[model samples]
Target: MGEIAGGIATAGVAVWLIALSACDIRSRRLPNTLTLPGAAVILVVAAGTGHGLAAVAGAAALFGVYLTVHLIAPAALGAGDVKLALGLGALTGVYGADVWVLAALGASLTTGVLALCRRLRGVRSTVPHGPSMCLAAGLVVGLSATV
Candidate 1:
């Protein structure tokens, strides 16, 4: 039963990430509707699975970091990215701090590379970070599962 529930939760996270990534790529926006509820659902599931502390810590850490970035340079990191971090952090946090750190690094590096590519192409518009975030988290989750 627990395994079944965990699988369902994982699926939910995957779907949520994919949906948000698509939306962000298309409109450069992450809806509060998806971000808020997705975080809540993951947190609740984490608590139920005895990983509440890690999940909360991860969510808070990411939220704080992103929020500070958004505050310092609103043009650099948008509010949507900050909000999206809550759920991604919780998802990786449930696995462990190591996984969370890996996901964070992956997201940061992927975004940086993407931005550099865009700059090289002379497209001066903003690069959507949400897809990078989602991809990193999803990849980390998949890799952690295999390990």
Candidate 2:
């Protein structure tokens, strides 16, 4: 039963991420409607599972790190990226730190590659980050399964 519930939750998250990616790509903005509720759901589920404090802390930490980066290099990242990280962090907190790290690494690497490809093509680096967020979410799910 737990496994089934987890699978359903994972699938739901994936669908949510895909929608967010589409919106971000089309409009360059992530709607609060998607991110806020998603974070709330993760927090509620994590708390119900006895991982409340850790999950909250992880989410805050993720936000804080991103906030710092945003402050330091505002041009390198966007507000949507920070919000996306918060959602991913909350989900990762439900799994574990390892999954969180894997997700972050996956997102960063994917973004870097895309940026490089765009640069090589002599195109301006205006890559939307939603796809990277989706990749991170997928990586988190895969890593959680391994654990």
Q: Which number leads on lDDT? A: 1
In Å, residue 117's CA in model 1 sits off its true spot by 1.0
- What is the C-alpha local distance difference test score of each model? 0.91, 0.79
| Model 2 alpha-carbon drift over 4 Å, by segment | none
Off by over 4 Å in 1: none
Q: How many clashes would you count in candidate 2? A: 0
Estimate, for each residue in 1-147, the C-alpha lDDT of model 1 and write its tens digit.
Answer: 378876886788889999999999999999999999999998998898788999999999999989999999999998999999999899899889999999999999999999899999998887899999999999998999879
Q: What TM-score does each of the candidates earn?
A: 0.95, 0.89
Model 2 lDDT tens row, 1-147: 299997897788888888888988889888889888888888888888898887787788778877788889887778878887777788776677877777767777888899899999999958877678677867777666776
Weakest 10 consecutive residues, lDDT, candidate 1?
1-10
